[model samples]
Target: LPQTIVDTVVTTWRLEIRFLWIGSQCIIQDDNHDKVIEISCMPQIYGNACLTILASRSSSVTEGFLHERVISNDILCAKLAVKVFDQTAKIAHLIPQRKNVELEPLYRRAWALQERLLSSRKLSFGSLQTRWFCREMDDNTSLKDDSRDGWTFRERKGWEELERFELLGHWIKIDSQTADELSTQWYFLIDTYTSCEMTFEGDRLPAISAIAQRLAPRLGDYHAGLWGRNLLSQLMWTRVNKSKLAKDATPSWTWATAVGHCRYTDNDLTIPAATMLAMLAMTAATAFPTKISGAASAVTLGMSVTATAQAMETVTPCFILATLRCWFTLLKY
Candidate 1:
């Protein structure tokens, strides 16, 4: 009945619908004594779109059966997927909502929602009303047609629409930028998902790759570069998944640490940002405590990394030039 459960289900259900639509085979494996569910098809699913569903389902369910499969691989995948899908769906559909929509109160509304979800406290009506309107505006600033001339009313409507568009645009920009920035990083994580190498002490590499890809496509360019790197860094120091790292030794954190060590900040110009990060990622795979030897597949793997880094470097100066032109255009606007 709770909003959290409802939201969880809606999100999870959508992913389930997507996976089912794609005919994905979900596999749940027990690694390091914990049950790890891996949902994949021939191409495999990437990003966090499926996570809310799986995590919510896993948290909310007791019984887990959907489509029955006689084949072992299909059976395992189906069972895991069904269990995860159902539980999360149940949780997502029970969230509550307010009757009135507040204009231009985005962050404040979000804060209130978070407080209500995390703590059992409801926001004060007076506070909500005050926050709903801008401080300079009055609560009685009737959205009604009688108060203003036709032109003024039309202008207000246009401004409101523009504000909403800008908000949505900003969100889209930040999200897409992040994914673009971290695309290669997620690719690295996906390729070396089972590795044990790491830089920080306690990090969750699986989640890093999983969510980073999903998040990147929706972020703005500048913010994406900032957060994608931070998210990679967080995965590097994760201690909870340490046991998994010990067994695999090709931990995702290795890249995190390596990238951190060889960072191409404004202060340091030994290597360009694109080149340094690319090299750090490739180098970390081999030099870490685990020594995973990702280079072993030089013809297949090493070549890709090498080519990608080279390509990014070759194209970067041009990218920067294009970006500056766009910045100037926006400033002129």
Candidate 2:
């Protein structure tokens, strides 16, 4: 009986999400077909086990719906923490892992990325406040309410008195301004029917294809390569762009599109082995000759890292070729 209810709710939520994200490229977790609403089901310690629920997986769906606002905020915070840690770890590999200094920019960047995921439509807070404020907090913020002037987080006098009144619904702001920003965004209150649309806007085809092509042979798993490529692209995008719109707004184009624009031929993975090899040979033809004219050991070490990265870029084709050859050899009985 519980499973049946969960399934019904889950299916509806999925449909709602699909309607919201009409034409964007998003990779959603394909599992969890149940729609039973729940709160904080994900294991925080495991880190990557963050489950984005459609409804909830709990027996009592109402409890899940009621607790969602606070839980949603917590989930966003946890996701951001994970990003900060992961990015810091990766950046440490590019340079020496040093302590005593904080990566402020990186943390900020991570927060922005988290915001994009949690509040992409700029309507997350409104959804929570409107839906749960009156029921959970007993603070009604409706169109008829005199406080319709603005939604302020600032604590003002007599604000506590307003808490006694039952919040009905939120004021609709068709256009977004600093004052009306909160009003415009959707707040998913106890009204289980409430949902918001999200747009998945970002271009990362080439990068994912490139990583997949490279890692396919060595890993003996084409899907793994593709998955890795997709995962890396997602991480990088999330790390760099804080908001989905920001990520979408970015004019970041992939090399595959820039090189040539045919269905299959232009794709770097599908290029001729000989032609690709020749390009690598030309690039690697001058590895060490481009040394700095006058640089001390410290400067040279920094330059060495940069030069190594550049050299790797040039020889990346060879790595791809080797991966292909390895895959072919495995396939040959």
Candidate 3:
């Protein structure tokens, strides 16, 4: 590198940002494919990871702001990630500390929830000592004593507890936050989940299919990423960085369509679900029934490519009208 060129780049443009760079994009671009089509390839578990000591900058990147590690690599973690219910807590206290606890780095990383849920057994390295959790353990972590709930693990009831957990637990991450705020749940889920590195951007939907499937029966229809119920409110996603866009990753209408990070950062600017519902109620109150356009009635699959409906928030007639008008309006422009 010449001194003159280096100085010019530094002065003209701000940062020569560098990090882990995989050449899949470069390989594809040399041939110039219009779209990076997602292929269907399912693995045994949700996904598999490779643990290797590659001589890479990411392997050595341990300083300042970018020091956080995702829980995907050493990704297997059992339940008891968050505060367990009181019933589980009381029983775990009665159980003895028969197993060893591994307290190293369990409480960090958002993806730990996925690893924790997927793995059959988990040895958590927490703040204090290492805690053990397995399919057969009565109690795992000393959560009662150490701010983590151990009751669910006690009584050797970990597996049945896990079945219920597998179906019910994942919702907690979304519920815990959205139940309180009620507006930005989908944005939170996307901001945390999509930021993760994947083998292909196409693998995004397949990786999270289980969660989507589980929620379908409960949340009605599922759109590409947003829920049908909360479609309009959730669709207000703005890219954090305009330069990086995932234009072909998804349809032009979805947040997933954009490449960079985005969010419904300003909910105040958006109309409330309650207001939308109220308008629907008012329209229905009139002599003429407000006809919900057929396209607006669904936010599911096989619809028009322009169809961008999905479910998320509370169910209501206004939801259809609100998001339908929004979709048509967006398509029009």
- Which candidate wins on TM-score? 3
Q: Candidate 2 on 1-333: residue-level lDDT in tens?
A: 344334444544764644222111122333222111111111121112222222222223233332343323222222232366457322111111111011212111211222222211221122123211222232333334433323333221134333211122122111222312221111111011011111221222221222222223332222211122222221111111222222322222222112121111111243223222211111232322221111112222221111112222322332222112211111111
Order of models, best lDDT first: 3, 1, 2
lDDT, candidate 1, 147-210, per-residue tens: 2422255444444343331122322233344444443333332233323233332232332332
RMSD of each: 19.2, 23.5, 16.8
Q: Model 3, 28-66: lDDT tens per residue?
A: 543323222211111113233221111111211132112
TM-score of 2: 0.17
lDDT of 3 at 54: 17
In candidate 3, stretches whose alpha carbon ends up further than 4 angstroms from where it belongs are 1-113, 117-121, 124-184, 247-249, 270-333
- Name the Cα RMSD for model 2: 23.5
Q: Which 10-residue window in model 1 sums to the lowest lDDT?
A: 324-333
- Best lDDT among the predictions, by candidate number: 3
The Cα local distance difference test for each model comes to 0.27, 0.22, 0.37
User: How does residue 21 of candidate 3 score in lDDT?
Assistant: 22
Runs of candidate 1 exceeding 4 Å displacement: 1-25, 28-60, 63-204, 212-247, 251-333
C-alpha positional error of residue 29 in candidate 1 after TM-score superposition, expressed in Å: 3.4
Error of 1 at 224 (Å): 19
